[model samples]
Target: MKFLIDNWYLVLTAVISGGLLLWTSLRGKSAGVTTTEAVRLLNREKGVLIDVSEPEEFAQGHAVGARNVPLKLLSTGEPVKQLPTNKALPLVLMCKTGARAGRAAGMLRQQGYTQVVAVAGGLAAWREASLPVEKSAA
Candidate 1:
């Protein structure tokens, strides 16, 4: 069309922008839960919070009641001894930001975890929400 040809730059920009938006939305949808939703799952569905930080980082501070299972362990593709054997239990994963947790969630899903979600914004978001956090005694 004449109008599209005349404004090809604008049309291209719009198309690229739309593609980026669609990609982000689709990528984000199934990968994470907000702090509030994480809390609801923990309280209402008895979800287990799994912190994927390294031992040193986890001991610094982590979500209260969160169990530490380093990302390295999960990456090995072997059974993580620290993880609960009941895959039916909802597992909420968190890390410093959300990146590691997202990868960890995907790994867990591959392992047949029926209900797994990463905490959006991870532990930083949890702290931002003023949720309880505790340092390891060791």
Candidate 2:
């Protein structure tokens, strides 16, 4: 205990760092939906896939039939007006990364969307899985 007492500051730092790492690992495991799982939900649950990409990026390429409601617009409450489905439909949000989609999903949930989900790996995972993408006609 002499060594720990002499290096109390170092010991405290190590304990705090270890606890933070443990908490982070546990927290990181529960976020987002995998591509296959998302597809299964889409097919079985009739989930509405909402692509939260900008207009230009969306037009370049996006999941076939995905409704493009840019994150900026969605955040501003404009996309809800344009959403084709009612609030009862299951909403799955997707973006280049899961970050924006997660935010969108949270917003949707706050807006009384009970079945809102965020696509785990986002569009990058869909492309990696060899899924079809639709490009807007130039």
Candidate 3:
């Protein structure tokens, strides 16, 4: 007790950090892949990236070669309209932020997509990493 009292700041800091980690985990905000990792997956494993943003946001800007599949359509089992039929193929989901992509990843898994993951920071992270982005101009 004496040691704790002397180092109260350290103990409080440790407790707060542990609590934050626990809260994030309980909230289902677990980590995902980085832009570099996504690129590696794409180049080495032929992974497909699906943007879960609306068509308008997709047209605004997205990872180069990403397909727009909107979250609502995915929730309805639409498979992004042009998704490949192979369940074994890897599918990477992305959004403006990582939140929607996380939800879409769960839906894809429920739809029997064996390999699905969300980009850690979504398109914003991709852009921050200096990766190429494309637009539809529509």
Candidate 4:
């Protein structure tokens, strides 16, 4: 008790840090999969690579064969027209930095997508892996 009292700030910091980690885990956010796993899903499961970046961002550079489905359309809570009709099909999502893809993954999971996953590092990681990328006009 005396030690804790002397180091009250340390205890409080530890508590806050632990609480944040617990909250994040309890919220069911995915830690996301590596680029290698994403590729395996794409090749083995015939997963669709859905780039959640906006059209302009996607046009700048994106994974080869990735279909554009902006996060805005997904966040509306309505059925996304661009998604595959077969909900059971694997869906691999990515964005510029992966944050939007994570949010999009949660949204898709709520919509009954059984095999949805986000790339851990998004396009940057994909590029780092020397994966193919394509560019287009917006």
Candidate 5:
């Protein structure tokens, strides 16, 4: 008790650091999909790739054969409802850096999609890997 009282600042810092470490581990477990894994899913699982980038960004360049759903449309639940494929098909969600894709994946799972995957690192990583991209007609 005396030692803790004398080193209260150190004790507080240690407690805060431990809490942050625990939070980080928990957060890391929820991360979905890496670029390599996503490619495997594409080739092996035939996952349907859905680009969540905005129209303008998507027009600049996007994965070849990827369908654009736009993050805004997904948030509003309109685009997903219009998706042609059945919900059971494996769906791969992708965006600029993957943050939007993660959100979209969670939204899809909540909507009863069983096999939704977020493409980690998203189009940036895809482009970095020299993968093919298609330019939209302006």
Candidate 6:
């Protein structure tokens, strides 16, 4: 007891740091779609891939049939013109990294999209997995 009381500040800091680490790990596990799962969805289950990057980024290269919907529009809750009307379909969101996809997924869920998912590593991971990408028409 004497040692703990002598180093109270150190003990408190360690406790707080442990709690923060635990929270972050839990959060990551709860979100994100793996590349293998994404491929299965696209190939067998008819999943719709939505790229949330800017037009220029999307035009560079994207999942073969991905529809572009800028993160700006999604974050603001503006109606995306290109989204399919069928909300029952599984919609996969992607960005440069996985971060924006997660946010977009949340916004889409709030907008009444019941079946929404964010790609774990976004377009980069898809490419790394040797998936096909389609370039925009010049």
Error at 102, model 3, angstroms: 0.6
In terms of lDDT, model 3 sits at 0.87
* Colliding pairs, model 2: 33-120
lDDT of 5 at 69: 90
lDDT of 1 by residue, 1-138 (tens): 999999999999999999999999988886699999999999999999999999999999999999999999999999987898999999999999988999999899999999999999998999999999999988
Write the residue-wise lDDT of candidate 6 on 1-138 in tens digits: 999999999999999999999999998865798989887777787888899999999998899888999989887777777887777778888888878889988888888888888889898998899988888986
Pick the TM-score winner. Answer: 1
Model 6 CA lDDT for position 3 = 92
Clashes of each: 0, 1, 0, 0, 0, 0
Q: Give TM-scores for every candidate, taking all chains together and pairing residue i with residue i.
A: 0.84, 0.76, 0.78, 0.78, 0.76, 0.77
Q: Report how far residue 127 has shifted in candidate 6, in Å.
A: 0.9
lDDT of each residue in 1-138, candidate 5, tens digit only: 999999999999999999999999887756667778878887898778889889898899899988989877877755464454578878888888888989988888877788898877888888888888889999
Question: Model 1: runs farther than 4 Å from truth?
Answer: 1-20
**Candidate no. 5 TM-score:** 0.76
RMSD of 2: 3.5
Residue-wise lDDT of candidate 3 within 87-106, one digit each (tens)? 88888889999889989888
How high is the CA lDDT of each candidate model?
0.94, 0.83, 0.87, 0.93, 0.83, 0.87
Instruction: Give the per-residue lDDT of model 4 (tens digit) for 1-138.
Output: 999999999999999999999999865446688999999999999999999999999999999999999999998889877899899999999999899999999999999999999998899999999999999874
Full ranking by lDDT: 1, 4, 3, 6, 5, 2
